[model samples]
Target: MAESNIHTLVHKETITLFPVDYRISRHAIFLINRNNIDSPLPLLSEIMRSKGFKVTTDQEKADYIMRITSYVTMPTNKNDQALPYSAEFLLSMREKLPVIKPLLVQSGDSPGEQMKATAKLVHNSNQGILGSDASNIISLGSTFGGGAGGLIAGAAASVIDTTASIFSRNSIREGLAGFEFSMTKNSGFLNQVSGLNVYAASATPEKPEALLDAAIGRAAAEMERD
Candidate 1:
């Protein structure tokens, strides 16, 4: 698939795609440089594991490959540009899959700041549970009027009766308090890939865990979409 090359502070897009069953066959591998990291592959694997994706060291068995590219922009006082040390994670899927999306793209000036942001992104993206077990919770409440319109027209209804009914309604509302619903949706698609499917981006501050988790979670969310 063709990729985009647009550069923005933070880039994100959900390309059109058909639904695919991620549970049946989901496997991925990571291709990250170790020079700038201290034994991060295992941590990356664990993070992906949390998203319900199979982490494989065998590149051939991977359904998709994750590659991280990083760049540093030196402080150019003349151009009024601040130092930008950032990393980008890319997902390359094998075969023609239904949907492949950039769930998140994050950038930061320092590794530590990036890690914190990455943790938050992962927590949000994985907000509800993953897979079919995913869902959300919402609570609702309502009030009743006890005057004019509160009573039925042409009925022998008295204020006492109306009040009783209102009380009953209030009781029902109380019982239904803290009601929740599912927030999960069928996702996992990408437009023709080029090079601009960035998910989350940050500036100034940086962190390591955040970058790792963001990249891993993004790829896993795409594959694990229900």
Candidate 2:
């Protein structure tokens, strides 16, 4: 098959949390919790610190406040029978952040599977959100900071390549749906921000958390490039 013909089945979306020009320092505090999943605050703190971000307890010294929460949403769709339950993972970053990313992982067929899938989906979603946040800070800086037009062009090309890769893997795309990712090019970060939503089917293996860890590791490795 041609390289262009290959795709990964994984679905993803990213909202512009900080405007492309939003000023963000290298300090943050995680005030994250969840009604469904275990506390990810410690894990997030460690991850941020490993990326050279100063994890502060003081809100005054933090550049951003990261909040993550997960919950089950009752059925709003008529045909969502096999996956009636919506396991949602929401990530917010700002002074009074709102849900910038609302990732949905559908439940399984039976009630038992649905509950298990919901937990997996929530965990994985949290993982992906944190990992993406780390990498995005650098990517946004390169595109929005003080770079040439080529910088943005390169970023756009990268986005296209990523989408191609995801769609190439049939397995990754399998059992996944309602996936959406986008950002505003001209929005200022000082006032309003954008959100991304990643929706997937069956909250099973290779959960979104795995995807997140991989992305975050890559991004953390590149922090020194800044």
Among these predictions, the greatest lDDT belongs to: 2
- Tens digits of per-residue lDDT, candidate 1, 60-95, equal 665544433232221211222111122222111112
Q: In model 2, how many backbone clashes occur?
A: 16
Encode model 2's per-residue lDDT on 3-93: one tens digit a residue. Answer: 2211112222343454443222443443433222344455545544665645566556555444433122212111221111112221112
Question: Which segments of candidate 2 are over 4 A away from where they belong?
Answer: 1-17, 21-27, 34-40, 70-191, 194-212, 218-226
For model 1, the stretches where C-alpha displacement exceeds 4 angstroms are 1-19, 23-25, 28-43, 67-196, 201-208
In Å, residue 45's CA in model 1 sits off its true spot by 4.0
Best candidate, TM-score: 2
Cα error of candidate 1 at position 144, Å: 62
Question: So what's the TM-score on candidate 1?
Answer: 0.30
Candidate 2 has an lDDT of 0.31
